[model samples]
Target: MGLGWIRRRTGHRAAKNQPGDLDMEALIPDHFLCPISLDLMKDPVTLSSGITYDRQSIDTWLEGGNFTCPVTNQVLRSFDQIPNHSLRKMIQEWCTENKRYGIERVPTPRVPVMPNEVSEILFSLAGSARNLDHQGCFECVRRIKNWAAESERNKRCILENGAASVLSAAFDSFAGDCGKKNAIVCEELLSALSWMLPAFDEESHKYLGSKASLHCMVWFLKETDDLSVKQNSLLALKQLLSCDDHTKHAEALAEIGGVNDILFKLIREKISPAITKASLMVVFYLISSSSSAGEKIKLSFLEMGLVSVLLEMLVDSERGVSERALAVIDSLCDCDEGREKAYADALTIPVLVKKILRISEMATEHSISAIWKLCKCASRQEERVLVEALQVGTFQKLLLVLQVRCGDDHTKEKTNELLKLLNPYRAGLECIESVDFKSIRRSF
Candidate 1:
């Protein structure tokens, strides 16, 4: 039979049979299949637009720059994927019945940790840690960490229930001991604490203030060969460094034993993008915090060739990554050493100029600010830099910025300052003009 004819006949038969369709092959309901993949959904997740699809398919769709419902074409308010647990159970049940037809049964999915469960775990952990119940605390910390690792929501719960205080106290009790048991327990607690640090801000001061917690996290970053543990430690340390109010914490982060070296190695090795980005953020916070310590941190990053790393990241296709990379560059360029390093890279000026209108407004703000810093702080040794900017069509890009209103007031002000600076350097008092301005304006 022709495939089209068969499909039409089957549709008629299906409509006639309705819910009574009992043929084994066609028994699988239409709703069981993902709209995108046309297969039984192993893990169904519902979109904000009220459409359901297999998790892998929907993740692929969203990752492919889609933000609308596939079935309804409605605009989505959020990208959050909610698990359709009831649909998943039905699909699994159907798969089980069709095993004779060679259909494999879907495995049960892991249940995300609930907030109440996390609260129970946190309460037990706090009570155990307080009563010096090392074994009890160890078990509780392990459970809490597993829960936090399972979901972002659970991580927030872990933080809100005083996980930080509990973990810090546990680490302090065990940090001084050199036995294998103590070290193992502390490592477990530190791993758990790291996952909660990003969301929980209540214990930032207390947790970071503890010498034991700092030492343990630093030790984990420096001594551990496991990338997962290192990634967690980096995240925990980043929160501490970012949230600490005292200059001592900032200075400690900047001068911590092997901190910069480890960060440099991670960035240079490109182990994992997540790890590198976390390390970069830690360095950014460390450098951007204290004015007295800023120069030292800036010099540290410059010496580590961060300018080259950041310039490369600007070309990344992902806008979020590019935006963050630019933010670090902006922080680094606040000092003369950093500005000189940035200007020295051959790609720096052109990349900054190109990204002005192409990236997000925040990115544009940082790019313009970095360029202005370079131009505003230009020295006698780098007089040709301005000429280079003009030669590379920086003036045309700035004019485009002025015309398009691609960003906020800060962006406009920076562009104006850069143009004012360049005006003086223009040859023969001539106003720079671009032939494509009219077309470019229309596109913008």
Candidate 2:
């Protein structure tokens, strides 16, 4: 009877003290809570406004392009954040006392990198690059990359300290060097540049767009077996070509012999979905930048068998890859040579028809646009293309697209035109059936 009574009492106490049954917020001191997150303060820091918050929460608020305090709503006089060591210690003590309540003590936060430290690192990198000290450059760049990965605050500090300019200068300085050590240094520099891309200034963009820098990227893309090196190279090229003078850059890329072939090879290899997408974007940007360049590049791409590669990409690629592939195809079909190449490929029309209303609105739009060009612009091959499209259920798909309003006004217009082109033959099944695939093959 005594044992039974003790067991009943213990069960009641355990149930009463259950963590889920307790109001943890009520137990914690109000001042111990971060104003931003309303949770226990970990790594508390004080703003210039005399308001305290968790370091991470405040860092996030500042990093989100805000120049004012979250609580006070006053414009910040400076970006300096002072560590609230006293409050952090108090919170830790409270957590230690509440260990039985499942509270864990927050670990001490590491001090964020300051602007001066970033400046020193950049100086070291510049000096190493100037002296042709590949080893020193590699070490400095690796450290910078580590800092970039540490925290958003570190990244902000690094960028503010002019890391992008220094890195680009180093990259341009080492442009002519070719050796294992230099290659490794170059790769590290590119990786660091990739991290700083979002913060690249006008000067950095100019340096990256220069002839030597562009060639360096092309060299990495063509020679390096490292996946990361190739990826970073593609990313840099994509950024450079995305600027306002993209046509000039595109022409520059073309002047770098074998760039088109290199990009096509990357796409054909299917190394990784990201690399493939970047390669495709570079190609798309290259051809779509200027009409003259576009026509020349499209013709060159067609001769190199770009249409077949795009058609194959459409089969099982991710939505983004599929959308880009369709976009490229749409761009390609703008030229007569592009349309002929697309028509010559047996998979082209069927792939375009299959893609409509299946992938995305943009994909549907691009697909419809390409089909319009192939069927409407083929001149002598127009009838044969329409017959082939109808045979492959293009007529029915077009009608479905219209009923569902799958694309934009332009797509709707193309859809209606294609329907009109195929409607007459839709009733004449024997005329479509009698169309010779052999004759269509010869028309190409």
Candidate 3:
């Protein structure tokens, strides 16, 4: 039985009350419903334009990039949501009257976070915190994180009120003293900082500038066995290192030690697919950021035995993993040392030839680029590297790449250059003649 039955039987506004056949939802007045959620208001709050809504609904709407009042369609002057005490009291009274229909009063929501509250949370996180203090700081940070997650307004409040500086200070405090430090607090703080990184704009650089923070990241990667801490640290490091100014800090990153070792070790360990992808993204950003730092990054990767590991990843079935591996090889092969190492591998030439058009367009470009670099050496100095390419059917692969109509223009251009370079030496490769090299030679 419901209010619909009663309305159908009576069909009049002055009909007697049918409490025995009513729904709690039917008893709630339309004005007491939130426009956004279309539900009975709980903790009703008023916006700047005098439109009222449930606090949770409006906060979620504001956080999701909505700035206008849902009912009036007027642009909001501010995000402030003042409590509608009178309306809340009326809603509560109505719910009480309908208590027999299973209506329960809404509990008062924890006070909506304000700017000063964010500041207080940060203030508690600073200094030499130990034991119970660390636990208390973690709890405070958890509260701020919860509030920020609630909506975009809280995120703005936290960032505008010095959240970044406080996080950096907390990082310093945690790193400065060890007697009270634990992985739980450290991971939570780093994750919170990571969440806020995107919202900080240029201030992100200042927070990440701390050597202690950088060292803490490296320590997390190298020393911690906790999976979550490692992932958060990697994400935070990726966020920081992907910036354009990484060139200025590349030298310092290199000097901090263990960076290359941990990256390669994680790659070889295959901890998880996400961790590996993130590690590859970090390496790609670092190597591709600047030409001046490329050699250093290449040298470190080589010292950490990255060539063999990357060669293994190149064959992975996952396209993203293999594509990133090829990209890394392309960047690593930019230097003479990287070239020497890659050229020495018997599988390197064959794998590069095999990947010509079998993978993505980007992978095709990277593969051709790697072969181009290798053949440049052979064409200029008639080095044995050219002989190795010919031995592994490199020219045959290039001919296939040239014939594929679906390949990108960049791959076609590189293929043409490689064919031209090899044309001069076609007569010397008489050892392997499975295809009509002369026919392919004429097309080139």
Candidate 4:
């Protein structure tokens, strides 16, 4: 009675006054609150246990791998959430009645997508792909992409119902003919696939790992001028390269003409951090796959001025790009030509020295490994390289690295060996400083 009397008085005054004049705290009923979030349910949905929760709250619960109702703790028979239209309408009406208290009415919620709806979309796409119906496939994929963009629930439903295989097949079919219409459809398909990237299963990977699929992605990377299309293509290729039979895929990618050059171009352009990182990772995978393919790709990358491009990226303040650049550099230095190219670059020694113990543990390890390779393989300019290492604080960083045990045992051994190599030059710094390190270049 006391609360009711107060609310009546306040509501009367609020009706005559403007919004926010009356405090609505303690006025909202308990039944209007969602069980999980304890907030007003805008889009109320009822679970199988006859409990109502906000759609977003229940979705988050289910998506987090929980299988039971939050309050009852009973295992859910199905993930389907029935919309509580009556409760939502009540909440909306309450909000409208209390408009003077600054309450905003929630809009009518869209019907949630179901698994069967997703299956229907996929069926249409498969039919279009099978018949090579470009227009039909385009319409179907556009619908799927729109749904995917709507909600996480829709994406989960779309992927769970087998969107990947259908999209891959459609992409492959459209990719065969690179005409204007087909390119448009392929771009749309890539846009849709980007949403489900790196979440593909083994079956999906099989479709994406095919030789024709690999070539199609490479084509997008090379020929497409659109930034987003290129980015999505890189994302797809990265996921494909991470599959079980990635080495075989890597070999196939290496055989593609000008693939290394295209990757280098993307890195050099500095288009965006994400694109740059994905491109670098793709390069890493290609060059680190199998011995034969890795060597071939590494040599190709080295010839395309890979050292210069990586050195440029190493100076970037972005830790991810810097770390990846160091890693690729380490791999590149495994070969004789790679080391020679690195030594030829004036920025190589100083950059490596600057990154050691400064970026990250992994970065420091890569920097040290690259330095070891350069100095260890220096036949003509061995003393000069060692002197440069000492002059740039490499000796001190190596000592500190050992003190901290920054990397694995192999890295530690390399650090120790590097320290040993640079230790002798410490006392001879005075005489070593007399020579011009920049002018001393080895004949490649």
Model 1, residue 293: displacement in angstroms?
A: 2.6
lDDT values, one for every candidate? 0.73, 0.81, 0.71, 0.81
> Could you estimate the TM-score for every candidate?
0.67, 0.84, 0.69, 0.85
Per-residue lDDT tens digits for candidate 2, residues 122-211, read 999989989988888988998888887878778888988899989998988777663344677777789899978767877898877888
- Superior by TM-score: candidate 3 or candidate 4: 4
lDDT of 4 by residue, 1-444 (tens): 112111322456565674555655436777788889877788998888888999999989987999999999999988778888888898899878866665667889777678888899888888887787878888888888778777777888888888888888777777777445577777888888887876787777777677767777888888888889889989998888877878877887888888888899999898899999999989988887765988888888888999998997787658899888998899888889898898788899889988876667888889999999888888865568888888777776677677666889989989988988878888755232223233222221
Q: Give the Cα error of residue 377 in candidate 1, in Å.
A: 1.5
Clash pairs, candidate 1, are none
Ranked candidates (lDDT, high to low): 2, 4, 1, 3
Model 3: runs farther than 4 Å from truth? 1-45, 53-78, 82-112, 127-136, 149-153, 177-185, 200-204, 286-294, 353-361, 379-416, 419-444
- Give the poorly placed runs of model 1, Cα more than 4 Å off: 1-120, 127-134, 146-160, 175-183, 244-246, 312-318, 426-444
Task: List candidate 4 segments past 4 Å from native.
Answer: 1-26, 63-67, 74-79, 97-104, 179-181, 402-405, 408-410, 428-444
- Pairs of residues at least 3 apart in sequence or in different chains that clash in candidate 2: none
Residue-level lDDT tens digits of model 3 in 202-288: 555655656766777778888878777788777777776777676655555666777888888888888987788778877876776
How many residue pairs clash in each candidate at the backbone level?
0, 0, 1, 0
What are the clashing pairs of model 4?
none
Q: What is the TM-score (0 to 1) of candidate 2?
A: 0.84
Candidate that beats the other on lDDT, 1 or 4, i.e. the better one:
4
